[model samples]
Target: MAFGRNKNRRRQDAAQRNEAVKGAVRSKGPGVMKVLALTLATGLLVWGGVELRRWALQSPRFELAAVSFSGLQRASRVELLRLAALTKGQNLWALDVGALERTMLQHPWVKKVEVSRRFPNRVSVAVTEHVPEALAVLGELYVLDEEGEPFKRVTPGDGLDLPLVTGVDREGYVADPDQARQRFQAALEVARAYTKEAVAGKPERLSEVRMEGRDVTLVAASGQEVRLGEGDSEVKLQRLARVRRELGARGLAAEIIHLDNRARPGWVAVKISSPVSERNGSAKQ
Candidate 1:
């Protein structure tokens, strides 16, 4: 009886140990399955992303079908297209927008460029061109914008009737951009003043604005040169307008008008050839 009881106790202990092992295994099984599932999901996501990228690159849906350009004045659309190298049937997803923009900016006329991928098979380009304001004579003639920035070199038959800005060299501009800019600003100011004072129905056109240090010499369309020494250009210009009106009223023309004296702002020294009547009277005398 004792032996049978010991045997029965042993059997019960073994059965309990087996049940505990099975319960622990059952608890850890779901955790292992969850880890495996998470790893598989991550892998699938990575593979799916890679496949999507591949599809996007190789898919016909993402291929460029058309290219459109806008805000182009001087830059040719065909030239820009050639520079961009974006051909039809090229993968839109593979294009480098920044590179294309840099390529377009290589053209001197383009001030600003914007490139974008229009969804579903189109690329769009928008450009802002530099507007020529005057011709800056620096070795070769270069186009000066309103901001006094020299943007492009002129070719033959450009047919720009703008004012000429002299005394600005490439060396000066390269050595001191700020000083060059200030000089150009002053030149533009002088040009504006001249333009504002129109005689008759036509605008007063300037032939050239020569800069000498801080002083400026303006050559008019009528072959008269005005020496406007620095300080208070507005006042000087006002006095100049009066002088011009007086001369026009008397049907007189001056070879040179000097308004360089600041203290005598109202005074002007005009050089004129003696009239035919005065010359004939002097001859008779």
Candidate 2:
């Protein structure tokens, strides 16, 4: 009987061990399945990403269709495209916008530019060119932009019917560019103020703006000169027009009008040359 009991005990222990092994496997089965599923998903995502990129780059749908340019003053579209090294039928996604902008800036006229990629295979470029404002006589005549930068040498073929800015020479400009720019800007300011006023009921035309060391002088198209010392430019210009009108009423022509009175506002000294007698006299108002 004892021998029979020992055999039964061994059978029960073996069954218990078998159950424990089965339970452990069942607990780990879901974890293993989760890992396999996660790996498969990651592989699919990577493959999809690569395929999408490839399609977008190489597909005809992304091919460049239209290229639009705006704010181009002197730069032609063909020239701009040549500078950009870009053409239509190329892939839009393949073009680097920043590289193209930097390239376009080398056009010698473009100052500020923005290149962009539009949706559905379109590219747009917006450019701002340096506009010619005045002519600077710096040994060699050069063109001055609005920002007082002397950009290029004046050519005969260029339509440079602009106001002449004198007094800042090439030597002085090369020595101190910042100070030279201030002189140019001062001349331009006088030019701007002169454009607003009329003389003797006719439109005032500016021929030259000369910066004469802390004083600005304007020579009109009619050979009349006006000197503005430092500040109150617009007011001085208005006063000049009034003086010209008063002189015109008396049948007298003003050779020069001095408004350079910092101490005395509205004080003007006029040099008159009578057209009838060619006599010159000084008048203060």
Q: Which predicted model would earn the best TM-score?
A: 1
Question: Per-model C-alpha lDDT, please?
Answer: 0.85, 0.85
lDDT of 1 by residue, 1-285 (tens): 999999999999999999999999899989999999999999999999999999899999998999999998878998898887878999998999999999999888899999999988999999999887788977788988888988889977567888889888989998998889889988988887777665432435788898988888988777778999887777787788888778888887777889987788667888864567775543220
Winner by lDDT: 2
lDDT of 2 at 172: 99
Clashing pairs for predicted structure model 2, backbone only: none
Error of 2 at 261 (Å): 3.9
True-structure RMSD, every candidate: 4.9, 4.9
Give all TM-scores, in the order shown: 0.80, 0.77
Candidate 1 clashes: the total is 0
Candidate 2 stretches with Cα past 4 Å from truth are: 1-43, 198-201, 262-265, 274-285
Evaluate model 2: give its TM-score: 0.77
